[model samples]
Target: MQSSRFVIGVIGGAAAVVAVGALGTHLLSGTQSTTGLDAHSTVTVDGHKALSGDIVAGRAQSRYHPLPWVGDKVSDVICPTGLKAVAGATVTCTGHRSDGSTVSIPVSVVKASADSVTWKFERS
Candidate 1:
């Protein structure tokens, strides 16, 4: 009876250790981190023609500065479908106006990729 009890206790302790180890590994692996990044959306900033002007989207807010520290609402654009404007690829932009003016603009790719990008104006 004493030997049987010892064997059972050893098994239970081993199982608990394995479970804790697995949980710790999963938490430290960083497989569930997002950092609020939307890689599927394209990014646009100010002075970028075509995408410039007043625009709005989710988590997209801007504040302009004219004086020492003035803030005004601006616009930002997100592709959400990824962009193909690579080092050699060309970026074609279209301008939309509620009035009546169609502007077709082309943006030369200075630097681009498929993973991530930075938008000076757009946040998400």
Candidate 2:
């Protein structure tokens, strides 16, 4: 009977240690924020013209909010004016997070034409 009790006690202690370890890992991971936007897509434009900063910023914000684990953490996105509607053009945009931090988002025009422009947000 004593041996059986000892074995049960050891098993219980090990289970407690595993439970505590799992809880600690979960708590530590909860404190971290995983907010990022690495997206690319095409947008339709009216004519062969430069892309507006507002359009770019709006699109970035829209794409970033629905991302899993990010979920509106980035409140806004700001881009420069006069983004050329031509392939190979690049710009750096700033993403403002809810924590009052900013992230650099690089935008590049991958494909462009008279009626549409495909842009990519490069990882930074």
Q: Which candidate achieves the best TM-score against the true structure?
A: 2
The best candidate in terms of lDDT: 2
lDDT tens readout by residue for model 2, 1-124? 9999999999999999999977765553331122222223232234436567666776666665543443445657888663567888777888887789787777777776665667766433
Candidate 2 achieves a global lDDT of 0.62
lDDT of 2 at 64: 59
lDDT of 2 at 94: 85
